[model samples]
Target: MSRRPYKPVMSKTWYLKQPSYRNYMIREMSSVFIGLWTLNLLIGLGKLIQGPATWSQWLALQAHPLMILFSAVTLALALYHSLTWFRAVPQVMRIQIGTSFVPAKLITNAHIGAMVGFSAIVLLATLWGV
Candidate 1:
């Protein structure tokens, strides 16, 4: 009989065992969707560059229910990624103004406010075609 070397068994669901690990995994995985969305945007830009008809076709493709669902999911994941990263800024970096350190909640809230403001501006500009 041949003796086989002993190998440690690793469970596939090990990350799910801890909430922190699961959340970390989720935050990390969200980047994949973000990257996909970026690629999609780039492709759409390329289509626009090709011609107005090409861009219209691309827009029509995006109107499909499946693409709409994918976009929604990707948007949600991107939001999650942004929230987690912005919230972690205080913990990862110490910001001091004079003798007092800035609060993490304040920093996170400021970032969230900035994001909303910028998004609103972009939406309005896009709608106004400016």
Candidate 2:
């Protein structure tokens, strides 16, 4: 195999300049996002347990214009993170069936299907309130 000398790509923009830098940035940013999301869930549990008054405060917080906007942003970020993760999941937990590689599309579709089903369940549960 012939090898070529490595050449570095230089760019004025910090993140776009290096692939490694961009990947590291993504990793760090995702960790922070995941952490914040978990904390948000914990806050939700607190609001639930602290009685309807505290829960009403939480609901009011959710009703705030800023919170609504940030919730959308959070959903977008989570969707991106989940897509990246689901795409790589087949490779991580690869199944062997007579030494053939699994198609990535199948994994993606399965993930999408599961998400849709889960969403439906959550919606129904919320509506029924049982």
Candidate 3:
């Protein structure tokens, strides 16, 4: 008789068992949409490089309802990913000031603030065409 290693049975939805696990899975899954968004942008860049006609067609394609919906979903996932990453930063990065360490909330809040500030700058620049 040959002895075989036993494997424990686990459900495919094991991550759904805990809120943290679910969130982690969602955060990881968000990368797929983010990757799609990156690919979309790269395609647009290529179209732009091809010439004005191709760029115009790409821009028109983005105006479709389906593309708009995809953009919205991707934007939401990207924001969630960013927020989760910012929250985890405190745990992964330890910063000390003299004898004491900075509060985790402070670190997270600073990251959120910076994200907002940079986003605002980008929005303004885009609106101003500068």
Candidate 4:
């Protein structure tokens, strides 16, 4: 194999049409951003699992004003991501319940219902079933 010098030659037109350029910049941007926030969530979980002291420390950190502000932003973005994921479940897995073809919207709504129900269960458990 002959060795060739790597030239830093660039062309705007070619880069514009490059699939990597489009995929890297546009299609995967939000996924990457959410991936970052997901990492944060995992780290938070890890800290919480360390023990009550660590978990309380993390909770106090969250109550700080700036953290609270960013938490609000990430919360909204996460909700948007969750809804998008839930909406795609029906498309990804078509359900045939019993003898009829269930609609995609109905399946998506069921997914949303399950999510809400799970949240309610947690809330009720926290409240000691009052």
| lDDT of all predictions | 0.92, 0.78, 0.97, 0.76
Encode model 2's per-residue lDDT on 1-130: one tens digit a residue: 5598788976667886779677656755776776776787799889999899988888888889987877777777777677677776887876667889668788777997898799899999999995
Candidate 1 C-alpha lDDT tens digits along 29-106: 988888888999999999999999999999999999998998999989888888888888889888899999998899
Candidate 4 ranges beyond 4 A from true positions: 1-59, 97-100
Query: Count of backbone clashes for each model?
Result: 0, 0, 0, 0
* Alpha carbon lDDT at 67, candidate 3: 96
TM-scores of the models, in the given order?
A: 0.85, 0.69, 0.94, 0.56
Off by over 4 Å in 1: 1-9
Per-residue CA lDDT of model 4 for 69-117, tens digit only, reads: 7767666666666677787788788878798878999988998999889
Model 1, TM vs. native: 0.85
- Model 4 / residue 100 / CA error / Å: 4.4
The weakest ten consecutive residues by lDDT in model 4 span: 22-31
Off by over 4 Å in 3: none
Name the regions of candidate 2 deviating beyond 4 angstroms: 1-14, 18-28
User: Which candidate leads the pack in TM-score?
Assistant: 3
- Give the lowest summed-lDDT range of ten residues in model 2: 23-32
Task: In candidate 2, list every pair of residues with a backbone clash.
Answer: none
Whole-structure CA lDDT of model 2: 0.78
Clashing pairs in 1: none
True-structure lDDT of candidate 3: 0.97
